[model samples]
Target: MHQILLIRHGEAAKSPTDADPGLTPLGQRQAETLADDLDRQFPGGEGVRLVSSPKTRARQTAIPVAGRWQARVDEQHNVIEIPSPEGMPLAERGQWIRTLLKSRWDTLSPAQGNWREDITDYLLQLASTRDEGRFHTTLVFCHFMVINSVVAAIRNDLQVVQFYPDYASQTHLAIDDGKLHLVQLGQETNIGSLIQ
Candidate 1:
C-alpha cells in the first residue's frame, strides 16, 4: 500500500484578493511545529516524497518540512486550489468560494469539474506508480478544497466540501490494489471564511 498525507497550507498573510499570498507569522510557526511532528513520525524523512501546490502559501508551508528532510519539493499545478470563474474580480472571490463550499461536485462548472478530475487522476497515478527502492509516502502541501476533493472522491461522495481541514492539518490516505482508502480525516476547524 502507498501512503499519502494531505497537508493543508498555513494561514495566508493577506486576504484572498491578493491572488497569491504568503503565510502569516503564526502560520510560519505552525509550519515549523508541523515539521517537528512529521519528523517524529518519519525520522530523517527517509522513504518520503515532498510535494507542494504551486501557490505561494502551499509552497511556504512545505519549506520547513523540506528543510527538515533535506529534500527538494516538487511543485504540482494539479493540486492547486479550486479555480475561480473567468473574469471574476479578486474581491469577489471570497463570496464565490463561500458559495462553492455549499455546492456538490456534480454541480461544478465545466472548468471546475475538469480541475477536480485532473487532481484526482494525478493522485491516482502517483499512488499506482512504484519507484523501486525510493519513496512510499508522499507529503502533499495543498489547499483546503484540494484535500476535501480527494477525501470526497475516496468516499464516493458528491459534496464539494467533505470536511474542514485546519491550517497545517494532515489528512492520511492509503492506496492499495488500485483503490484509494481514507486512513484518517485531518484535524477540522469551524471557520466562517472559506478563503482565509
Candidate 2:
C-alpha cells in the first residue's frame, strides 16, 4: 500500500489584488511546527517523497518539511489551486469560491471538471508507481480545493466541498490494489466568513 498525506498550506497573507500571496508570520511558524511533528512521525524521511503545488503558499509550506527531511520538493502544477472563471477579478475570487462551495462536482464547468480529473489522475499515477519491496509515503503540500478534490473522489461524493481543512492540517490516505482509501480527514476549523 502507498500512503498519501495531503497537507493544506498555512494561513496566507491574503490580499484582494494579489494573485499569489505567501504565508504570514504565523503561517510560517505553523509550517515549522508541522515540519517538526512530521519529522518525529517519520524519522529521517525514509521512503518519503515531497511534493508541493507551484503556488507560493504551498511552496512556502513545504520548505521547512523539505529542510527537516533533507529532500527536495517537486513542484507540480496539477496540484495547484482550482482555477477561477476567466475575467473574474481577483477581489471577486472569494465570492466565486463561496458560490462554488455550494455546488456539486457534476455541476462544475468543463474546465473545473477537467482540473478535478487531472488531480485524481496524477495522484493515482503516483500511487501506482512505487519502489519494489518498500512502502512509500508521498507528502503533497497543496491548497484547500486540491485536498477536497481528492477526498471527495475517494468517498464518491459529488459535493464540491467535502470538509473545511485547517491550516497545516494533514489528511491521510492509502492506495491499495489500485484503489484510494481515506484513512483520516484533516483538522478542521470554523472560520466564519473567512475563506482563504
Candidate 3:
C-alpha cells in the first residue's frame, strides 16, 4: 500500500479579483510552521516523493519542505483548484464555491463533472505508482477542492463539502488493492469567513 499525504495550501494573498493567488505573509508563516511540524511528525522526509498542484499558493507551500529535503516538486495541473464556471468573475468565485458546497457533485455540468473525475483519477494513478512492488509515500501540496475530491471518492460521498480542511492541514490516506482508504482526515479550522 502507498500512503499519500494531501496537504492543503496555506492561506492565499489575494483579493476577490485574483484568479491566481500566492501565499500571504501569514500563509508563508503557516507553511514554515508546517515544515517544522512535518519534521516532527514524519521525520526527515527521506524517501517521500514530492508532488504539487500547479498553482502559486500550492507551489509556494511545497517549496520549503522540498528545499529541506533537497527534493524536487513534481507539478501537475490535475491537482489544481476547482475550475471556475464559464465567465464566472473571480470576485464571485467564493460565493460560487459556497453554493456548490450545498449541492451534489454528481449534478454538475458535464465540464465540471469531468474536471472532478479527472482530479480523482489523477490522484488514484499517483497512489498506485510503486517501485518493485513496494509501496511508497507521496506528499502532495494542493488546493482544497482537489483534496476533497479524493476524500469524497474514498468515502463514497457525493456532497461537495465533505469537510473543511484548515490551511496547511495534512490528510493521510492509503492505497491498496486499487482502493483509496482514508487513514486520517486533516485538521479542520473554523475559518467560516476565509473560504476563499
Highest TM-score, which number?
1
Q: Clashing residue pairs in candidate 3, if any?
A: none
Model 1 spans > 4 angstroms off = none
Q: Candidate 3, residues 112-139: lDDT per residue as tens digits?
A: 8888888767767875544524437888
Residues 8-62, candidate 2: write the lDDT tens digits: 9988988888888999999899999999999998998888889899989999999
Model 1 lDDT tens row, 1-196: 7889999998887675589989999889989999999999999999999999999999999999899889999999999999989899989998888888898999988998899889878877776555735878989999999999899999899998899999999999987888778999999977742465
Report residue 190 deviation for candidate 3 (angstroms).
Answer: 1.1
Between candidates 1 and 2, name the one with more favorable TM-score. Answer: 1
Of 2 and 3, the candidate ranking higher by TM-score: 2
Ranking by lDDT: 1, 2, 3
lDDT of each: 0.88, 0.88, 0.83
